[model samples]
Target: MTVTAAAHDGGIPAPAPGTAPQQVTMSGAINRALRDAMTADTDVVVFGEDVGTLGGVFRVTDGIARDFGPDRCFDTPLAEAGIVGFAVGMAMAGFRPVIEMQFDAFAFPAFEQIASHVAKMRNRTQGRVNLPIVIRIPFAGGIGGVEHHCDSSEAYYAHTPGLKVVTPATVEDAYTLLREAINDPDPVIFMEPKRLYWSKGSLPEDASPDAQIASSFGRAAVRREGIDVTLVAYGPSVDVAMQAASAAMGSGWSVEVVDLRTLVPFDDQTVVASVRKTGRCVVVHEAQGFAGVGAEIAARVQERAFHSLHAPVLRVAGLDIPYPPPKLEHLHLPGVERVLDAIARLQWDDQADALHLPESSPACDSPASDSKGGAA
Candidate 1:
């Protein structure tokens, strides 16, 4: 009755004409996955708020309902809890449900069903029934989204038992991971970093667009190779980590980057291996620091690669406070400057191993702005 979490290696089926294996936005790639999954499995249904006629707020689900008909792809009432509860029933009845959670903070209303039923049904039934549900949530900070629009809530699901959690930062992963989530036998929290929706990346010129999954969702991918330090990130903040790595190269530091693609079945081996090679590690995420995903990654790195460590495992994360308003978000979310600043803090020389404390306990690191609990 015990169900373990799982993941997949990215794969896509043969591509149709015009849908080339070229550069595509993350949203576009996801759209391709939805198209192919529905084409492959009639039991797979997609439903959520504003998902049908509207094509979803971000158009990730566009053209789906029109082509697939209301029975396969449709909209639901504005109740998150009901949407998930109904989907759970459908899953129990042999249908594979792929639901969309419009926003990060908006997914909470459905959390009751997600944690209580969607997550535990497989084990509770003693393997009689499994919930193959993919709850796609558009999350993370950036894009000037305010209030309930921007929140990194993946830790909640990742901490919950029985649920497989993952986030994709690249276009290829967007297509491949969503496809894998739909095909997984258990419930999966597919967190899509909304900020990266428009970010484009190249795919093989002749690759297929159908669907491909390699079953390596639990393994982290090395985005860059180096020896001085390891920079770990996933989802939206991965771009920030890459920027820091490039900047570090100019400063005579060879930095390595590891994208922790999946959260629940964390790829400890890949990240720990990177730390063992670099001797220093930094985990970055748009989520807050305390009890965050980064904390677990840092702990694992220290535990497995302790002997190879040259310094403490540092973390670059969003401010602990609630997400700021659109205008003031710049100071809240971790950016290139923040990442580089953290990278610069790692001691590279033996003589500078001793830590240097700030001259005074001043909260104002930049004279331009005061952290007066932001009025905007």
Candidate 2:
């Protein structure tokens, strides 16, 4: 079907800001967004393994095929690369195709299609064509599943030049951000934290633009603001960061939390500003410590807030080994305890009982200098 400008423009509008919160799970909110987008725009097509009859592994696309019909919402073969290539072709022809990767690790096979074609197409064509495809991958640990089932690979996509990387922490963002990604002209890698699928939150009934989360690319949302220390996080790690903040509060430390909703084109400005205020910063993520998102953020913080920094930038992230078995996953993923431990390190050596810095350490020079706080 042809996608007209008007057809893509109108749909169930987002409810007004602060309106009634439609209590729903994160997966439900994503499903709602996909449904609304598909209903509004006939050109919007969704396809992936088992998405048709099974509603996807996590049921995030449940009932979409039945409601939208097989043509609009259907399943594809078990080839991730083929799925992405097909979607890229569809997008080139002016169709908005939303492809789903069964799991985080499953997306790797499609990496070639995404990195070489989907991401670089527009830039290669110099605006002659746009790949407005959305590749959704259920990611992150904490479901008690096996290795490949729960990997957080945001850093890989964020490191890519032409792809927009986004991870929603709350139900409200899950709905709004998905809709926004579908509407955007560029390709978007939408990373959904699998553990949060069942987590519930309030959503709006009617469509209001304000209620819609801002489609600010590469921007971070200040989940909470404080003056003592700044906690940087995304996806599943965001929950851990908040818990750390609460724990530190008991010790009379006010912590600021920044959720980098979009990783690529990250909102370094927000992070820099917060770090400038708090003077101490800790980055948290579920990915391994080596070359992970936390490493990138820590580097940026050093570059932007070098003088303002009280203590060196710290990172709380997953271990270097492959994602462990479900039983040992707790040790693999960063938790509130790990975050609190980092916070305590930040508060150490304070003379007036305020957050203080130790003697200028080597870590203070550059984020790359210390692999301990760098990527796993």
Candidate 3:
């Protein structure tokens, strides 16, 4: 990877009074979130490998050391386990620590610390002590990264109790979710899709980076509304789902895209509601399909919206194998064609045929009763 010089401020500055919305990159939004959080709370400290001086591998923490001083934003030895262990110690002392694990696979060395101490601290201590720590892991495989550099490890963290896992797919969410994770009482696994680091979005000029997470923290965002089918995705796959949704329009399919911003505190209501409306769902993810987040989502949809579904829930995910090398990574990652293929397999025929029930069966409803453009 090519290393670039840190920009002067390293983040976007708030616009002056009466200015319009400004465009901000995902990395810039995250940097601004860290800056805002640290500025708002003196207890907030950002530290990890190359986080201070180098501004992190992707420069997401750029200018933090210069702006907040070395003590608040300092680098550690190139030891992943030690970095997390140090953060645990800091949290025990009442400090809110935000630590980064250089890459997705590199975080494996610190899994013990995360799953044991960071996650179970509150429950283990009977609520006496809470570790408000944020573990930022750059994940997913879209940047042509090699084996150790690109692994979608969200499933591992999401399956562990007491840890709230969240991944942002847009610039606005990158800022909002990071702000929420830093202030949350429980430990949070903030999965940053490495490939989306440079993606841009428009946010209000005076957007409050320190905005409190009242009720929108864990809710899924319906990016594009549709009545035909629902495309569930998060992080790097969200862009792919949106692209597929756009392409589906040409074929007269009004596809809905749902971004599951927080995986742990999943908003099943939103997803289920979408599936109920469309009567079909296709979950997309860059991680391996076997027992990945997509499987969990599919199960949840089928369990809650069983009668509403006209076709069985499907998943378009990465092959169940090690992340491929740089050149062939695209073949492994779910693309528009793969997602579209899954959408097509939603069994748009009559409900009885799709469900394998007789047309005159009491359980099989009439095809005309299906929602707009669904099944029938």
Index of the highest-TM-score prediction: 3
| Residue 318, candidate 3: C-alpha displacement in angstroms | 0.1
When summed lDDT is taken over every stretch of 10 residues in candidate 1, the lowest stretch is 1-10
* Model 2 stretches with alpha carbons more than 4 Å out: 1-19, 208-213, 350-376
- Local accuracy of candidate 2 as per-residue lDDT tens digits, 1-376: 4333333232233445767756788998888788777767788899999998888999888877766678998999999999999999899888999999999999999999999999999889998999999999999988998877888888889889999999999887888888889989999999999999999987655533224445666778899889999999988888888888888888778999999988977897899999999899999998889898888889989998899987788899899998899899989889998888788776344322212334475434433222222311
lDDT of 3 by residue, 216-270 (tens): 5669999999999999999999999999999998888999999999998999999
All candidates: TM-score: 0.88, 0.87, 0.90
Better of 1 and 3 by lDDT: 3
**Best-performing candidate as measured by lDDT:** 3
Model 1, 15-69: lDDT tens digits are 4677745677888788778876777777988999888888899998877776777
lDDT of each: 0.82, 0.83, 0.87
Better of 2 and 3 by lDDT: 3
Lowest lDDT sum, 10 consecutive residues, model 2, at 367-376
What lDDT, from 0 to 1, does candidate 1 have? 0.82
RMSD of each: 7.8, 6.4, 5.5
- TM-score for candidate 3, residues paired by index: 0.90
